[model samples]
Structures are given as structure tokens and as C-alpha cells.
Target: MLKQYSFEKTAVQSFDAQTTLALKTEDLQVFYGANHAMHDANLGFPKNQITALIGASGSGKSTYLRSLNRMNDGIATVTGKIWYHGVNINEPNVNIYEIRKHIGMVFQRPNPFSKSIRENIVYALKANGMKSKADLDERVETSLRGAALWDEVKDTLDKSALSLSGGQQQRLCIARSIAMAPDVLLLDEPCSALDPISTVKVEETLLELQKQYTIIIVTHNMQQAARVSSQCAFFHLGHVMEYTSTGTMFSNPQIPVTQDYIAGSFG
Candidate 1:
């Protein structure tokens, strides 16, 4: 049985005035039927930086990440505002498809389309009216390179994506997401299925991509969060218990609950 834990709400941390926010959520809440899955979450993601959401199982980290780009649509009731570029994207009539293009997501598992490696990256572009062959080719290479998979797969672009190893496939999925040129990328436990080497590669890719994209990642591995993210948020029992810089949060947590969790007393 899981141990039930209660925590007091601590103020979410903030970046300095000069740091620009790429995205933010205001009073966010999510519900599955009558069960409240996430509490009111107010958080900001600084531009060109990585922010990791850390929590144990069923702590609402994934719930909050999915709600950012309206992935919870048709499945749950998501309330509050997701602010991006001065617009509240959670409005009732907003175009979720359009919003998702600007804020792309990679799932917990590596889900490559059953198509050629090249096709997997270009399919979305073609569906969205990218008809120029030269542009598509350029995008394919650029995206793969951005994911750090170019040299290995450049010679086999015509081969089936499934032919690649697990780590390669996951990086291909990252390339697919990058092809769309999103302003923010959300990854949910992207390395859980990968081996140690693969996990390190993915972590390195994220660190490099942070220079060009605002990244929000959900990671169960506290070490990964400490390595890749500039800031971290600790969630517990549907509430954001604390948010702070990774260094401070790990070295000297402000909340008792955070300290306990980091110390491995309880998840």
C-alpha cells in the first residue's frame, strides 16, 4: 500500500526580472471525473532553459505537463490559463491543434511511426502543407542533427525507423518533434525505457536544445532532473510542494517535505 503524505503549500520560485518566461500556467487544475488529479498550479518556465517536474508516481507531475498543451482535452476537465506569448491558450474556443504545433510533446515511450526514418520526421510537415522537396530534405537533416542522430542514420534514411535500436528510435522521435520548430518542448520520462548510455545521450541532447527551446521535462529520476534542469518543481499529492533552483533544492531544500523526499525517506 502507498503511504499517504500531506504537505503545506510553498510559494513557487521565480526567476529574476531579466529572465523571460516562455510559458506559464495560472491557477491550473485538472480533474478526472470527480477526482481532482491536480491542484491549482501556478508556475513559469523561463525561455531557453530546462525545468524539470519531479515527483513520485501519481503525484500529478504528468497530469500538469499534459494540461499545458491541452493534451488532456476530451479526457479530463482542465481549468485555468496556459499563457504563451501574451495569449491565454486555455480559452474554450482556442485551436488546440495550432497550440500544439507551437508547444510539442514527446511521450514516455519512444513511439516512432511505422515508416522510413526520413518519413517519420517529414510526415507532420507534409500534412501541414510543406510541399517543397528541398525544404523537406533540409528539415529532415536539420531535425536529425538537432537530435544528435544525424551521422548514425543519415546513411539509412530510407530504412524503416524500427530497424534502429531503442535509443536511436527515441532520438528519432525527438527529431520528429524538433522538425516542427516548437517554442517549448515537453518530455514525460523520455529516458525511462532507455539504457544508461542512451539516457545520457538524451540528457545531453536536452541540455544542448535548451539554448533554442524552453524545455519542461517530467522525470522520476532525481539525478536526471538535477543534471539537466536549471530549475525544479517538487510535486506531492496533487500539489506543488516546492519550486526552486536545482542546486538549492537538492543542497538545501526550503520545505521539510522536499528535504525528506530528496533524502529518500519517502517518495
Candidate 2:
């Protein structure tokens, strides 16, 4: 039988005014039809840092992550404030397209286009009216370098993105997202499909990327959370049971639910 955990005991960290946040959620709740998928999720993501959402399957980590940049639109009802740059982006009148430009997302699996590597990087930019060859070329290089894929593919820009290895393709997807110069990047299990070596590459890329973009990642791997994130949030059955430093979360979880989940005794 599945163990039941109390929602009463919780620990979510709050940043002070001195610490700048790239995004903040207040009383964020998500519902799919009658099913409450996520409860009141309030958390702050510090600028240029990485935050990992760790939880078991169906715990609503992905649901909450999707709602951050309005990826849940038409799929689920997400209510409450998603504050970005002092604006409540959760408002119905807010421009989701603009919001997404600032807050980008990469999926669980690598989904690269059938086009060439260069084309994949420039597709959105061209659609947005960047017609200059020189500018497009520069963006392609800058973004690929940002994702740490430039050296490997610099000479093969015209090659098909799908022709690259799984890890390369995923990094390309990340490069595509960063090409927009988003202030925040959201990744859902970015390394799950990767092999150990590939996973390390992606993790290294994330560590470097945190110097410029605030990153929020949802991963089932606790070790990945400990390796990459400064702050960790533990989700259980739609509730954020604990939020604290990664070291503390792994070594000293405050709540029973969090401790059990981290110890692999539950979840």
C-alpha cells in the first residue's frame, strides 16, 4: 500500500529583497478538469542560479514547472501569481509569447528539427524578422557556444541536426532555446534519456549556463539535483513538502515526507 504523507508539515524558502529573483510564484495552483494536480506552490528562483524540483512520478513537479511560463495553457487551469520582472504574468491579458521569450523551456526528450544545425538555431530568429546573413550567422555561433556545442559542430553547421548524437541533439535544443537570449530557462528532465557521459556533458553545460540564466529543472534523479542545484524543492502528491539547500535536503531533510523520499524509503 502507498504511504500517506501529511501536507501540514512543509518548508519553503523565501528570498530576501536583497536577493534578486528571476521568477516568483505565489499561491500557484494547477487543476486538470476536477483533478488538483498542484497545490499552493510558492517559491522564488534567484537570478543566475539553478533550482531543481525533485519528486516521484505524478507528484506534480512537471505540472508546476509547465505552469511557470504558461506551457499549461489550454491543457490545464493554473491560477495565482507568476511574477516576472514585477509583472503578474499569470494574468489573462499577459502576452504568453512575450513571456515565453523571457522564460524558455526544453523538454524531457531531445526534439531537434529536421533542418541543418545552423537552420535549427536561426529558424525562430528568421521568423521573428532577423533577415541579415551576418546577424544570423553570429547568433548561430553565439548560441551554440552558449550551450557548449560550438566546438563540436562549428565545422558542420550545415549538417542535419538529427544526424548528431542524442546528447548533441539535446544540447542543440538547448542552444535553440538560448538563442532567444531568455533570462530564465526551464528544463524538464533534460538528462533522463542521456547516457552517463552525455548526462555529465549536459550537467556541465548547465553549470556554466547558470552564470547567465536562471535555471529551474525538474529531475527524478536526486543526485543530479545535488550536483547542479543550489536550491532544491521536494514535491509530494502536489504539495511542495520541503525546499532548502541541496546539501541540507540530501543530508538533513526537515519533514518526514522529504526525509523518506530522499532516503528512498518512500517515493
Candidate 3:
């Protein structure tokens, strides 16, 4: 069992409400067995905005991202307090499946199933018991277009997903995630394995998606963070060194550690 604290008690004394803001963490802490992966992390993510979590390896960047969608619980031992929709996600009564429905995730590597591209997207809807053929068709097409890969594959929806290039496969994964209509999309270093052109395509897709979903991305690329995020968070040793508008963070970081990290003193 891990001890936890309320957001108001440990993090922000006052949290201003936002129509677009979809998720918030107040003094969130996470431990894998005895290892504390995250420490005193606090953040507020506005809806329709992009937040980039940037840090060196083993800095708890991905750990913090996983907590939002309750993906960390599969590990043998995990504990943390996360809040979405004004309720504590770590609470016993909270439904994990329901939480994940609204909070989608895209992993670092594209893991498309050994199925057709159209089937991959439709399977999600079908599994969720969505039976409307018209709606399913609309969702599948919309999500693919949203990921910027529809035109290329629209003619061959039945084609095997495995046939796609690395970049296209990643986009298909994104399309599958979006077909679920999640309010918050969590991306963990999604472009690390992609080529330069593919990386730009992924970033561009995210930029376009920000109009309807709150986006949180964990990336080691400082330039990528600076290029795509509206807000940037720098993490060091499980601690959030600073969180602020991207412009302010890169130009004039409030904390010395954040400034040092930005200057490439140490990852």
C-alpha cells in the first residue's frame, strides 16, 4: 500500500477551473514496488491543448504519463493518486476500464495487430459493442483522416496493417486510438522510431487533433517538445522541475534546474 495525499492538500492550494482543462494531478506520487518512479508531480492539462513532458531517461516521464490512464497497475506493485473529472482515479471504486475509455494512449512503437487496416480500427468499435454500421464507417474514416493517412490507404481499407511502412503503421495505431473518441490522448515517445518525414507527420497530426482532445506527450526530444507543445514540463529524478508555457520555459525558466536542463548542462 502506498500513502497518498489530496491534490488540494499536497499540490495546488487553488485550482482554477477551465472548460477545456480535462485532467489534473495534485501532488501525485508513484512507486513500483519500493522504487518511487514519480515524486510530487503536479500538472493541469487544458482540453484542446498539447502538453509535452520532457526529461532524460529514467526521469519518470513515461511513468507519470501512464498514471493518467491507469496503465501502470499491471506491474507487480504500483501506487499513485491521479485525478480526472474531479474524482481520484486511485480510489477503490473507480472503474479502470471506464477511465481508459476516455483516456486513450499511443505507445512508443507502433503495434498494429496482424489484421487489415480497416479491421484494426473497426475492431475497437465492435468490441465496445458499437453496432451502428453508418457510425462505425464514419468513425473509421474520420480517425484515419485525422491521423493524416486516410488518402493513402482509403482505396484499400482491407489491406493488411503489416504492409504499411513504419510511419504509416504508427498512423494506423493513432487512427485506432482516436476511433474510440477519447477525450484525452496520451502519447509516449511516439515518434522516436520514425524517420524525419514520418516524425513531422506525427507531430502535424497531433497539432490538428488538439482542437478536441487534451494531449500529453512524453518525449526526450527537446526540439520536438518546443516545436509541438503549447506547455512544456521538465522532469528530473521523478520530480517536475518546472511547468509553464513553452515560450516562457525555454526562454526564461523559473527554476535554476529547469534553466540548466534547457541549456544542456545535464539531462
Candidate 4:
């Protein structure tokens, strides 16, 4: 039988005024029909840092992440204050498209377009009215380089993106998101579908990316969380059970639920 832990004892960390937060959520809740998938999830993401959201499946980590950029709209009722640059982006009148432009997302599986590698990166830019050949060329190179995929795919820019391996496809997806010049990059299990070598490459890319973009990753792998994230948040049964430094969360969790989850006794 699975043990039922109390939800009253949660440890969520908050940043000081001196620390600049790239994104924050206050009183964040999510509901789908009659189901409450997330509770009041208050958390802050420091600028130019990687924060990993780790939990077992169905623990609401992805739900809370989707709400950060209003991805839960029309899918779930999210009532909360999602503050990005002093703006409550959760407001009804906020432009979700614009919000997504600044806060990009990369899904679990790599979903690159059927177009060529160069076209894959330039498609969204062209749709957004960027027509300068020189600028478009620069963005394509820059984003690809940023994602650590330029060297591998630069020679084959005209080839179909589908021809790349699983790892390459995922990196191309990351390049696609960075092509938008977003401030925050949200990744939902970006490495869950790759080989060990590919996973290492993705992890290395993310570590480098934190110098330019704030990253929030939802991963079920504890080792990956410990390797890439400066901070870690653990979710359980629709609640954010703990948030702290990656070292502390894994070594000395403040709550029992977090301790058990980390110890592999339960999740």
C-alpha cells in the first residue's frame, strides 16, 4: 500500500530583493473540470540560472510549468499571478502569443519541422516579419550555435531536419526556441527521449545556456536534476512539496515527503 503523506508541511524557498528573478508565480492553482491538479505554487526563478522541477508522474510539475507562460489556457483553469518583468501575464487581456515569444517552450519529444535545417530556424522569424537576408542568416547561425548544434548541422543546412538523429532533432528544437530571443526557456523533459551520450550533450548545452537565458526544466531523472540545476523544486500530488538548492534538496530535504521522494522510498 502507498503511504499518504500530509500536505501541510511544504518547504518553498523565496529569493531576496537583491536577487533578480526572471519569473515568479504567486498563489498559482490549476483545475481541470472537477480535478485540482495544482495547489498554490509560489516560486521564483533567478535570472540566468537553471531551476529543475523534479517529481514523479502526475505530480503537477508540468501543469505548474505550463501556467508560467499561460500554456494552460483553455486546457485548465489557472488562477494566479505570474509575474514576468513586473507584469502579470496571467491577465485575460495579455497577449499569449507575445508572452510565448518572450518565454519559449521545448516539449518532451523533438518536433522539428519537415523543412530544411536552416528553414526550420527561420520559419518563425519570417512569420514575425523579419525579412532581412543578412539578419535572418545571422539569427539562424546564432541560434544554432547557441544550442551547440551549429557544428553538427551547419554543413547540411539545406537538408531536411528529419534526417538528424534523435539528439540532433532535440538540439534543433532548442535552437528553434532560442531563435526567438526569449528571456526564459521552459523545457519539459527535453532529454527523456535520448541516449546517454545525447543526454549528456543536452545537459552540457543547458549548462551553457543558463548564462544567457533563465531555464526551468521538468525532469523525472534525479541525476539530471542534480547535474544541471542550481535550484530544485519537488512536487507531489498537486503540491509543491519542497524548493531549495539542488544540493540541499537532495542531501537534506526539509520536508518528509521530499525526503522520501529523494530517498526512493516513495514518489
Q: What is the lDDT of residue 221 in candidate 3?
A: 93
What is the lDDT of every predicted structure here? 0.92, 0.95, 0.85, 0.95
Clashes of each: 0, 0, 1, 0
Q: Considering TM-score, which of the candidate structures 2 and 3 is the better prediction for this target?
A: 2
Show model 1 residue runs off by greater than 4 Å. Answer: 1-6
How many backbone clashes can be found in candidate 1? 0
lDDT of 1 by residue, 52-161 (tens): 99988999999999999999999999998899999999998899989888999999999999999999999999988999999999999999999999999999999999
lDDT (Cα) of model 2: 0.95
Model 2 TM-score, 2 decimals: 0.98
- Candidate 2 pairs with clashing backbones: none
lDDT of 4 by residue, 173-253 (tens): 999999999999999999999999999999999999999999999999999999999999999989999999999998999
* Cα deviation of 231, candidate 4, in Å: 0.5
Residue 21, model 1: lDDT of: 99
lDDT ranking from best to worst? 4, 2, 1, 3
Tens-place lDDT digits, model 3, residues 156-215: 899999999999999999999999999999999999999999999999999999987889
- Model 1, residue 102: displacement in angstroms? 0.6
- Superposed Cα deviation of residue 262, candidate 3 (Å): 0.9
Minimum summed lDDT over a 10-residue window in model 1 is located at: 2-11
